[model samples]
Target: MLRAAFLASTLVFSVVPVTAPPPVDSAVDCDYYCDDRDPSLPLSARRSPHRPGTSTPPAPAAVVCNRYCDARDPALAPSNRLAQTVVVAGRQVSLRFDDTDAMGWGAIAGAVQPGDEVWLDRSFDAGVSWGAGSRLGDTAVPPGFGDWRTMMFNVDDWAGLGVGLLRACGRPAGSSTIACTSWYRTTWNAWDRRTAAATALMQRYNLSTGLFDTTGWWNSANALNAVIDNIRLTGMTGYRYAIARTYDLNRSAWQGDFINDYNDDVAWWGLTWLAAYDLTGDSRYLATAKAGADHIFRFWDSVCGGGIWWSSSKNYKNAIANSLYVQLNAALHNRILGDTVYLQRALAGWTWFLNSRMINSSGLVNDGLTSTCANNNRTPWSYNQGVPLAALVELHRATGDPSLLTKARALADASTTSAFLNPGGILFDDGGGGDVPSFKGIYVRGLAALNRALPDRPYTSYLRRQADTAHARDRSSADSYDQPWAGPFQRSDAARQHSAVDLMNAAG
Candidate 1:
């Protein structure tokens, strides 16, 4: 289905047989040294290039969440969301999403405690990885310039009411709430933009019957992510309109004649509902995620020697669909205890994807396998690389196998290089038009998940460079973020903005 520019036929997707892994020290020098032979040594210890006695260094300053926001763009104004309060330990902490003057993450902005550190162990990843509490308000910027609380506020406000929602530009804070230009419409933010845009795309373009639109499912999933992310951060309420918009209520399944027939699109929404269930403690969302997982596994066959098909037509097997399969299983495994089936599915899918020759010699993941089961030689999309990176990391956590972690680290390291990034670490892949722009955000999200898992790794610093560059160079005075992070602002859309938001949050 993907008609990218470089699609080419290759020999049957030849199996890269699993020979005994070359000795850990001499495995062609991937991201870090591939050392999994020893079980007890921490991954950092195993990959250490320094002397045996060298101390494990502190995390780089650039990577971890510092201050929430600052005068980095003196232009940023306070646009707080519907304020909400939550009980932390026992005391209630009032939090806002868009406070230009907020102090810490959840506590009332400006509420700083001596030696205070935020404990970040979130389900942002399918599994729970703790960051061991980093210093709150840890940026080099001047005090009060920014705080952890308002970090995502400015971005979401701009995307929703600032630009995408209210279509207001250069207006002062709170102007978004009022009808300024004789035209008034309901406004949305990160809390609701994905659902709005995706539904619009679906209504505007879906030819398929019953379903909102095949393409809308992607943003539908994104909207679901936005809602989950909002509740996770600001302690506000959750919105399920995105789910209602894309979901087929009559059939009660995401993929059907009324919705996505493509397995991956269906899987995307299923994963979203899973995140919602994880956050909202709703069994309905979990049930939807499980059904989606079952549907994804149904597509898995021995046809290409075991990988999920891209569509029900069963003509092609792709990296995107398969990688998503891995991710869904990984997340399900994280949510479900005493269930080895999800882990089993994750292991099989990952194993097939890894050896399927789609990942070429440079460690870049190719697009899909041709009808003959050969590497299709399609231009590597960002999602292909990103989804599997987190999936593999999740798998490593599930099995306690360092080999999976080593491979995930390799993917993370290689992704930051020319395979995906341009100079200054701005992520660059295909052009910004069409769906290509959305792909990078998925990759960046994967990077964030990996960062949460390995807080001390350099991945966080590199991703920070991406977020900072995006804020500094990608956007224009109009507040619309452009393509190529550092280049031409041509063709900005929900995709680019969403990726930008993901990157900044990752930095935090």
Candidate 2:
């Protein structure tokens, strides 16, 4: 009977754009915590050898690019109409059709410069499209650094460096150059130099060790680097060790410095490692990913029904974390485990999203849950939208489920068509107002990944057009690629408060 029910639920849906209104409350039960519900049964313990002749899995889903570019069906050719570039990090960077349409948060980041300004605007209005770029004061800064000196520091800041490196890749577009002194970077270029150093730094400080660091074990950048080193040295320890640190281990040490504690952070770093593993085919990294996946499955709570909570705490469940995990799991599914079950779990989680979190008044995903959902919070985040759309594309491939693909298309359309985005195509910062170029980069990567996963889809052309725009803007401009210059404004009060380190790292 269970088999029949499962088979009946397996329906291949075509790409359907949902125009219905969002549901107030929808409950879906896939034994969300089945891994935890049966404590005595471990993930490894529950495994059964693959059953032959079950069925080939579904294809990956498709997503849109930077908000303006839509996924074109392969049957139909997509038109390539590009837009002007915006000035970010003190240079003119192409912004595709609109601001957010090119590369998002990443658009704001370029090769590190000596005196580049990292702006932070607190009263940013989401509705007001244009205004003076607010200069966020640097009230609080990490210790040891006297001021924001790009050259003086012994260790390069990961956040800033990551963005700079990504730009070098011409990832917002695509490039043959590795280190972009100008518009394009060579494949053999030094883009990985800072990345390796940043990874080493995080590990050296023992910050990346066991999932949790209650005692501030890996708190500082230096300390965290040590922990990362240990993991890299030893073979990737399986899921238990990784999860213990990320979930409970880190949660044990709480200081309220950041709203998100170690758990939230692990989600970010874990994915980072996973990406490295994907690129390198390192077995140890895969082992660590499995451990992280186990922890999430065991402790995952349906606080908002459709998503997992930020932490064990009852804080609002976020879309980004869950979405990140889904993508990680999907990528690691075939490599980590023996068969399609791992893919099944990823599908179940995504299905939950379609039923729960991805709904607004218009039935579209209204970004993520607002702090106001249960507590005071804001609704809508570009990252939330961009990341999930990318993940859905992956899910579409894993299960070949048309419904997943349909949902992804709808969200992609919403992201571009939504009024919240600037006319220039930049995502409204914090869903308020402001043009943060970094998100544009992020969107580009997400869209690109989706296009890659779904080769049959005609979305790549739309994405390529956006990439070309980013390329043309930074063309042959050595000044744009030069590292930032240092000045009083470099260490100004505004930069520190915004935690420039965190944002900069993601872009790279």
Cα RMSD to native, each candidate? 21.5, 22.2
For 1-508, candidate 2 gives per-residue lDDT tens digits of: 0000000011111111212223222121123221122233334322111111222222111122222322222122222222223343333332111111222111224443333322211111110100121221212223333222110000111221211111110111122211111111111111232232223222212213332111122122112322233334333222113322333333323332111232434454455456546545666556655655655565465555555655444454556566766765676674665667558667766766665544665433443465544322234555566667667876766667778767767776676566664234433333211112223434545654555555475455544443333223321211111001111111101111111212122222
Worst ten-residue run, lDDT, model 2? Answer: 1-10
lDDT measured at residue 417 in model 2 versus the true structure, 0 to 100 = 61
For each candidate, the alpha-carbon lDDT, in order, equals 0.50, 0.35
- Judge candidate 1 against the unseen true structure and give its global Cα lDDT, from 0 to 1: 0.50
Choose the strongest candidate by lDDT. 1
Candidate 2 CA-lDDT value? 0.35
Structural similarity to truth (TM-score) of each candidate = 0.58, 0.43
**Best of the candidates, TM-score:** 1
* Candidate 1 residue lDDT tens string, 226-340: 4455446545342333444434442343324222446776677777777767775878777777877887777888987999987666667889889989988888888888989
Residue 168 in model 2: lDDT: 12
User: What lDDT does candidate 1 reach at residue 219?
Assistant: 45
